[model samples]
Target: MSYRAVLRTPHALRTFLAALVGRLSYGVVFVSLTVAITVATGSYAVAGGAIALFGLGGVLVAPLRAGLVDRYGPRRVLPPLAVTYAGLLAGLAATTWRPGTPGWVLIVLAAVAGAAAPPLGPVMRAMWSQLLPDEAGRQRAFALDTVVEELLFVTGPLVAGLCIAAGAPAAGVALAAALVLTGTLAMVSSPVARAWPRVEAGAVVAVRVNRARLEPVLVASGLGLGLGALGLLIVAFATERDQTAAVAWIEAALAAGSAVGGIAYGARTWAASQRTQLALLVVALAGVLAVAGLAPGVAALAAAAALAGLFVAPTLTIAYLLADRSVPAAARTRAGTWVNTAFNAGSSGGSAAVGLLISRAPLPVCFAAAAIPLLLSAVLPALHERVDQQVEADPGAEHDDDRLEHLAGEAAG
Candidate 1:
């Protein structure tokens, strides 16, 4: 769990870097494609529709794709999809560049592009279980995963800005596709990936391990409410201020705060169960997000945003950790996908809901809307207590009740 261990372990380092590069590319691709399409058509609505289809493709099939990885291993599943996705992306860029290519045609290409893209998060997360058996080690790794994702979003937009400024926004998409392909190939080629265990029925799939892991997945979905709301608020607040450009940096500051928080959280150990920490962090998030709505101006919102983001990474890390431990190895990838699916669905739905509300109410209403999930998150103390009961029973779990108590009375009793 130490920094040196994560940094020094060859397999850990390799998995971490591969996931990082692939995610960075994914972060850049969507925005860059939107920019290219918007510039070409002079219609943000058209671009939005296309991007929505792209995201929908992934959301719809993520579990199925992840299941394939679980059943067949990453080596069998990732390479061909990566190659096909790369080709599709390149084709989409080229098609968009053609003079007067039909919008419908571009939309179809986008769907294919999304469908072909590798399920990077699920695969990498599944690998962590095989590579790191220590609970503390996995916790640190998941925290690092959150940090990498935050940094990727922060950097992705910057890269898109550069590509757009260069008068070839498609370059950003192509660049991202290239990075993902290269990184995925490298990851699969690694020794750990090649040796990844395939699930054989009745081998190690325990009944307890197969129990539903839906709680953390649901909380993760709830956690995305703020992020989705923030997406709309970016446009709403920026337009209201007549400095629409400032939204990017404001959001970047928030992501930066998240990344820093994740690093800090991982560097130290806490004497609390994952479930307890998640509940506390989520309640804290609710408070921070609500306070953000009352900020006097954009500058104030920036500070509030950063403060609000402080709990995000740690909360998400705990959710992933819970998912990893809750499922058998054969089902880990699929379980991880449930978390991803819920998170994306929440972000999209939350943004749309808040966007509609903004039209009928004050801007603060939008900010308040984002905090709704946090309220739901705050209600998870019961679930925390239940999960703690399970953990305390697990022989491998760190059961130091003297230092870390579940929120309720003895869960077993």
Candidate 2:
């Protein structure tokens, strides 16, 4: 779980670089698309709406797409999707270049483009879990991945910013498209990514309706809801303060702080006792809410947002770790999809709710709204542990220990 582990392990290094390339492309596409839309339509609302549509499209498509990944493997789904996503970006750019394009046309294009985007986060996570081959390694890998994601987000927008400054925001989108197409094709071709066989469609079809199989997904849905609220509050604050132009800066600072926190988490050898990580989550959440509520201008908000993000990444990282342990191997990708879908849906809903709040009251009201989820995250760990212990201690839990050992071994490999 230390830098030395990443330093010494060739598999981890290869897997990480591959994952990082895919992620960088994803970030670049988002920034480029948003900036392009804003400039082309001459409306910030249009750009915001396009981004929102993207989120909604992902939520709608991800669960089904995940089922495909589980059935056909990420190898089959990811590469073609990357190529199609690139084409879509190119099409979007073309649409913008034409004069007198209708807003509705842009909207439809955005919606379709959003739906076409790859599920890089889930795919990379699954790869990391497989690459590391043990619980400790998985934990460290997740922490490292979290940090990498933060860094990617920070840099993605900078690239977009530079592209926009160059008088052709399409440059970023074009570059993103190329990166995604190349990276996905190359990564999916790797021996590591192709290790698992595709699940039989019949088996996946039968399991689709099993409610018993969806418990972890449901819980993660709740977590995603809380985060969605946080996203809304941030948007409201950024928009109301006329800091829309600096949105990337704010995001970069927040991500930078989260990366720092995750690096600290990853650098350690022993896992922080679940109890300690939970306590830190609570303290961090409280600090985030307090800072957001203060509304001490952009600088203060930036610092607070970063502080809030510090714990946010670690909390989710732990959740994914628990998920890896809980779900059956055959169901891993599907289960991971559910967790991601829940997060997307929750964030969308949270944003909608806070947008309403912002319409009614001052910006600080958004922060107050963020507090509810932070408080819930603070409490969720204890409840989650108890439920987990109960399941583990059940007398009828046949082969549970052996299964855990096997899973740990898989992670360690």
Candidate 3:
């Protein structure tokens, strides 16, 4: 596979592995914080709110953080942030561990830690374009990244679960903190990472990109992710009846499906446009997830979840691929951050909105509510494809107008 060649590149393996470890926290911190807080306070409400604040921290920081990575590069920007990120995680652990700590303290600490979230994913993904510029190689690299992300999604909760079981939820949080610190240091020190320019000086450079062409796919994919978040909430509701044991299995199944899909999708390139594939997969997910809410047992729910997950990694890979291909190198970091921030906002909003609805509505209704966004997601791509086709069809129209103008000039002469 081209991926093998990609890894053979200088410093590729080291950078990729470090990135995998660091980005694992993408899924871990939320699980660790939520579980640990719930265990301490015996309140899911507080746990949920705390986790949301953490995400909000990232959302608030993404644009600025991305710009820094772009201007100064990861080596210069990440090391300090890595130290700060680990410190914040440690602080959160310490603050939340106290028995009588005010709830507000935990919330504030979570936000601060989240704002300090590492930029490993963005930097690493950006590096892939530089590392493997070919279409095949780049797609394979993205697929590998997506698969690792799926593993993180599955393993995050499992690791946290084991830590919580062995000690308390704080153990999980502490472990995650250590991973971030270790992984961040490793990533920044990698040869490729260190080789990146420290910073570009003089007036700040900004590149104007034509988003008119890319917006539809971006919106469609973003909404698809948001709907995926809605499905996650439905799964939460499915497990609400104290089916704690089943929750892990269901989540595992979902993660597994995404991993499998990514591997399979990356095995061969298809002729279809990325937008077409993205739209189709997301539309398919809408139906599967709506039915998933009606699953009669844990086993059934697990199967449904897996089916819903089948589309996730591929969709994300395409979205990431599009982001890389669409934006100029100068805007790479900002573009990556834009995609992430948008997706996070969508996912968090979906979960928050569904969390509110879950208490009052039937599980099926909540699941169906999630599907509504997916359906809307389908519309964006469809329109995008039509626009693309129209553009293709009228390619010569402008040239013809130019020809007419030339003839008019000749006649005037």
Q: Model 2: what TM-score?
A: 0.81
Candidate 2 residue-wise lDDT, 120-188, digit = tens: 777777877666777777778878777777678778878888988988887888888777777777678
lDDT of each: 0.79, 0.68, 0.74
List runs of model 2 lying over 4 Å from the truth. Answer: 43-49, 197-202, 205-251, 269-283, 295-300, 362-365, 377-380, 387-413
Q: Which candidate achieves the best lDDT against the true structure?
A: 1
Greater TM-score among 1 and 3 belongs to: 1
Lowest lDDT sum, 10 consecutive residues, model 1, at: 203-212
For each candidate in turn, the TM-score is 0.89, 0.81, 0.86
By TM-score, the better pick of 1 and 2 is 1
TM-score of 3: 0.86
TM-score rank order: 1, 3, 2
Candidate 1 on 207-228: residue-level lDDT in tens? Answer: 3422237667778888887788
Q: Count the backbone clashes (under 3 Å) in each candidate.
A: 0, 8, 0
The CA lDDT at 394 in model 2 is 88
